[model samples]
Structure formats: structure tokens, C-alpha cells
Target: MTLFVDMDEVIADTYGAHIKRVNERYNMNLTKEACRGGEVWQQLPDHREAIWRHYFEPGFFRELDPIAGSQEVLRELSEKYEVYIASAAMQFPDSLKEKHEWLDEYFPFIHWSKRILCGDKHILRGDVLIDDRSHNLEHFVGRSLIFTSPHNVNTTAFERVNSWEEVCSKLL
Candidate 1:
């Protein structure tokens, strides 16, 4: 099976990183639970532009912590499927290189050739796609699993997996 996995909120803890920075900068107590069904910036209207700018900053993607259990679960998944890392890297041009480096550091076994750092995911043809964005899953012809993120908490368009363990239970 060809399994395509998204890098950001799915395997990388980008949401948590944003929330952490926002909390530290503004001295507010913001939890993932508090931001459910909305983007972190949406929760902080005044600082929304500042929060969105985090993506444009250098090394932002490279410095993000990987979601817990992703390494182990992806390693196991790779053995059973033609696992490819599919990231929407073009939204932020700097992210392409940073994301490449991040993947090399955290997921070297996946290989450079298997990574698809692209503009649009609709071009991909695969058996299964695991992503945090519902729009990406919307165009997928195969099985689409929405990896839960705070912004997508209320999205019921696709099957959702809250953790790598849930992913393992379904796809592993």
C-alpha cells in the first residue's frame, strides 16, 4: 500500500509550538483544549498576524518537536507500506529546506526520494493519505484519514485519528 503522511500538525507538533510561543509572548494561559475547533491565531485576534508570521520565520519548521510516538509508528508503518512524507512546503518557501532537514534528522529512514514537498496535494495518487487538513483529504480518491489538530477538532468530513496509536490500530 502507498501511504502518504503529512508532516506538520500530523507528525510534527507545529500547533503546540505556536501555542507555546503565543503563551510565552502574551503571558496568557492557552491550552490545546482551549483552542479546539479553531486555529491558535483565531483564538488570539490581536496577535493573529504575529502568530501567522511564525511560519515565515527561518528554522521554524526545523526546530519543531515531533509529535510523540510518530517516529516509532512511522518506522513500523514504513516496513509494511510504501510510506512517503507529503508536506505542503510551498506555502512558506523557507520551509522546503527546513522541512527537508527536519525530516532528515527525524525520519532519515524514509529517504530523500520518498519526500514530496509540494504546492498542492491533489496531484498525489495513493492508496491512503493521512493529513491534518480536511481540504487535502477532500480531493483524495483513496482512503483519507484526518490526523486531528486543534484547528480541525470540529471537522467531521473524514475519519479522524487522534494519535499515532489510533493510526496504528487502523492502518498499521
Candidate 2:
């Protein structure tokens, strides 16, 4: 089986840093407790790019701390399936490179043969797509898991999970 995984919210807590910056800049009482599964983006979809650019522009990929148990789950999954990364990050090539480098450094067991960066998941078909994005779930026909995010709501054909451990349970 070949598993295609999303990068940002699936493996890394992409909004953790963003939330901190938002609080600092706005002086609002934005607690991490306020981070629901789909409200963040709903609140400010228009500012998504700008927020990412400001908070995640430099060394963001390199600074990506793996979600707890993510590395272990990927390592275990790699033993059985060909795990490939297909992030939605089509614009920032440098950030994409950083993601690859970081993955290689942390999960050295993952072979280069299975790694890939694609703008569209439909173009790179996989047996399973573990992504946080709802639109990408539409393309995956077989098994699919939607990693829960602060911005993913109206999605079907994808089981939602809050953590990598949950994903491991579903996939394994």
C-alpha cells in the first residue's frame, strides 16, 4: 500500500506558532484553548496567506515540530506501506525542500522512492490519502483519513482524527 500524507496540520502543528503570533500582535485573549477543529480558518480565510507568510515564511519547515507520535507512526507505517508525502504547498518551493530535508533528518528510514511533492492529489493517486484538507479527500477514492484541523469542516468520505496516534490506529 502507498500512503500519501499531508504535511502542515497532519504532521506539524502549523497553527501553534501562528496562534502565538496572533495573540502577540493583536493583544487579544487568544488562548490555545480557543483552537477548535474548524473555527480558525472560518474566522479568517482571507488572511490565511498573509498569516502564513508572516509567521511561517522563514525556516517554518525546518522549525516544524512533529505532532506527538508522528515520527513513530510514520516509521512504523513505512515498514509496511510505501509512505509518500504530498503537501498542498505548491507555492513555496524552498519551504517544500525544507520539509523534505526535515523528514529525511527525522525519519531516515523513509526511502526516497516513496517521497513526493504534488499540488494535486488526484494527479498522484495513492491507495490512501491522510490529509487535513477537505478538498483533497474528494479525490481519494479508496481509504482516506482526514486529520482534524482548526479549519476543516464540511467533509465526507474521510474519517477525522485529532492526533497521529489516532491515524496510526485507523491506518494500521
> Which candidate achieves the best TM-score against the true structure?
1
What overall lDDT goes with each candidate model? 0.92, 0.74
Instruction: Give the TM-scores of the predictions, in the order they appear.
Output: 0.97, 0.84
**Per-residue lDDT tens digits of candidate 1, residues 38-81?**
99998889887899999998888989999989999999999999
Residue-pair clashes per candidate, as listed? 0, 0
Regions of model 2 farther than 4 Å from truth: 37-49, 153-157
> What's model 1's lDDT at 139?
93
Error of 2 at 162 (Å): 2.6
Lowest summed lDDT window (length 10), candidate 2: 35-44
